[model samples]
Target: MTQPLQIGLVVFPEMTQLDATGPLQVFAGIPFFAPDPGAEVHLLWKDLEPVSTDAIMTITPTKTFAQSPPLDVICVPGGPGVDALLGDSEVIDFVRSQGSGARWVTSVCTGALVLGAAGLLDGYRAATHWAAMGMLDAFGAVPTDERVVIDGNRVTGGGVTAGVDFALTLVAELVDRATAEAIQLRIEYNPAPPFAAGSPATAPAEVVEDYRERTAAYQARRIAAVARAAAARPTP
Candidate 1:
């Protein structure tokens, strides 16, 4: 029997649920898409317990970080929790250790900031939420505005909803483009938004200013968190 490819998705309090679930639904379809598939995905946290999202939703992790076996892929999802995680030693250590050996290290939205916090993104071109893209430079990453950015084994998605795009891209890399397309069709992944304001460039100026003001506090915290993490990194 072919051993399965173990994939771990990190979960923490205040995370954006879609960031975790969107990619999960895509990867979960691998068995149906690939011939003789070999992949298993799990939600990982500090412990096997319920974690809250940015919204009212809460999800239970399938495995604890300490108990997880070596993963072939490790993904981190972002949200308000990212500010806290950027300064969390335990979570950063877990990400650092897993990423060192995983076949792929990925993130959705500001989750790239978490990877950056772990010192995994140095010299890498990564994607993250447009609102926070500028913050990547603090962690030594060159930020890209694309919906999905891939540099070697590191893949990162733009904002919350881009998780789907990130996952499909990863599927193509792991198996074949055909299988990935099949999965995309299976999920009816075509997106047609009613509004054309998904990004800062497309959104109305007033709306962009409002969002930036609303996120100012979180951005401030994130700035401090990234500084702390970067300062703590060991000297080469």
Candidate 2:
């Protein structure tokens, strides 16, 4: 019998809920496409306690760092909380260890920052939230501005909702395009944004400026965090 494909979706305090849950909904549906798919997703954290998200939601981890089995996939989700994780040795260590053995290492939004901090993204062309694209340079990662990017075993997604696309892409690679298509249809993945303001290229000049101004401080902090994390990485 094929061993179950173990997937670990990391959770941390103040992480954006959608970054984690969106991909989760897709991976959880694996059995629907292939009976006995042998896929299991685990919510991983430092402990088993519930952690608060950036929004009002709270999520509880299904496995602690110490107890998690060898996983086939390691997924890190991002939000403002990643600022602190950039310098968190415990979190970085867990990611580094798991990624060494996992078949795939991935991130959503700024979660790529966490993977970079862990030293897994060095020389990899990765994707991240546009606002933080420039920050990837601090960790030796070439940032690509796309909804999803796959370089070797490293897969990354852009901001928030892009997790779904990332998950579907992963599914297609793992199973088959037909299975992925079936899953997409089941989930009704068609998208029709009400406005064209979804990306900076299409947004009004004033809107872009306002967002830059609003996020300036946070972006600065994130840059500093990435630098610190990079400097502290053990010499390879």
Candidate 3:
């Protein structure tokens, strides 16, 4: 039997749990995941520390970044913590190293910013939360206005909820279409949001404007953090 594909889901304080957990759950349901052991998922962080999610949830890392197994896939999930992590040299260095070695590198929502900070997004077509799309250019990535964008081995998802779709798509890419479809069916992956405000273009102008305004301060902080990270990196 083929060895299980080792997958790493990176977590940090204040990260959105759904970004990692949703995908992790989907990948765990594949029959081959246990029988043939298609994939084995591990939660990794800078240390084996307990990380909090937006202050509402806490999770413990299964492994430290330095000790994480060589990964077939590495996923980064995002949330408010991204603002702080963007300037963390240890996190950036860990991400840069693992991303370079992994077979596929994936991100959900603002997690793309982490990849950008690690210098992994350069010259790639990537997507992030619509509210943060403009910031992608700052990191030299082409900002794609799509739910999901796959550029070579790097796959990125837009907004928070797009994580499910991203994981389904990744299942097809990494495993097989049959396995992905089965997992989707098992999970009843069809989505129906009660409101149509999920996208900026679909929401009322006032609502969209308000959302952007609310997140403005956070965005400013993230930009400054990314700038500092960029400045501190050794010249290549």
Candidate 4:
């Protein structure tokens, strides 16, 4: 790759900022990690406005979809806002258009659903947030249970935090493992959570049940949204 790497990350309302920023942090360190043939990561949206997140803060898009340069990678991040993205043709069309030409198509967490909605993951093994795992089948995707999955040029991360791992893996693909590891070391990407309850399998039964109960309505809405997006997607 003689040219500079151009990576585009999609941002929207109510998205989990970490899903994009986590991987972004890793990708942004490419210059320091391996100075030659540097990278340019663009935060993209339909317009150049500040997008809100699931948290209190908001993120501003660096480029509009129409204004973005050709991207080597197109990555989407996930959160509560993903439900609306399922039914959004503007975002879906943008992904479909850009992904068709990008060297890599990827997502973090439920952002996989957006790629699916764009018909980008058909017949590919992918990963998404645990809660949205079952939705992959609707898009003709094989849902793999892993923190990160790479099937051909399509890379996906399990959830929000997995974005860091996802990008590090992509960096290895773009450059080398040594560079990726150096970036990892630079970031000190160590995981030693205080609790072992991140996943449903490890969480207490009551805690899991309570979460399921709380999210039942949201999941129901998501299912319906997925159905619509799947139906609206063009067949390949």
Off by over 4 Å in 3: 31-34, 233-236
Compared with the true structure, all predictions reach lDDT values of: 0.91, 0.91, 0.86, 0.93
For model 2, state the Cα shift of residue 212 in Å.
Answer: 1.3
Q: Which digits, one per residue and each the tens of the lDDT, describe model 1 over residues 1-236?
A: 56777889999999999999999999998887674666888899998779999889899999999989999999999999887887788998999999999999999999998898888899999999998899899888999999999999999999999999999999999888998899999999999999989999999999999999998897888888878877875442
* Candidate 1 Cα misplacement greater than 4 A, ranges: none
Displacement of residue 210 (Cα, Å) in model 2 is 1.1
**Best first by TM-score, ranked:** 4, 2, 1, 3
Error of 1 at 54 (Å): 0.9
lDDT of 3: 0.86
What's the CA error at residue 57 for candidate 1, in Å? 1.1
Q: After superposition, how far is residue 179 of candidate 2 from its true place, in Å?
A: 1.7
Can you give the TM-score per candidate against the true fold?
Answer: 0.97, 0.97, 0.94, 0.98
Superposed Cα deviation of residue 92, candidate 2 (Å): 0.4
Q: Model 3, residue 115: what's the lDDT?
A: 89
What is the C-alpha lDDT profile of model 3 across 1-236, one tens digit per residue? 87888889999999988888888888787555445657778899878879999758799999998889888888899998898888788888888888989999889998998888888888899999887788887677899999999999999998888888999899888878878888888889888889998887899999988977997898788778767766654433
Pairs clashing within candidate 2: none
How does model 1 fare in lDDT? Answer: 0.91
lDDT of 3 at 225: 76
RMSD of each: 1.2, 1.1, 1.7, 1.0
lDDT of 4 by residue, 193-226 (tens): 9998888889899998998999999999999999
Give the C-alpha lDDT of model 2.
0.91
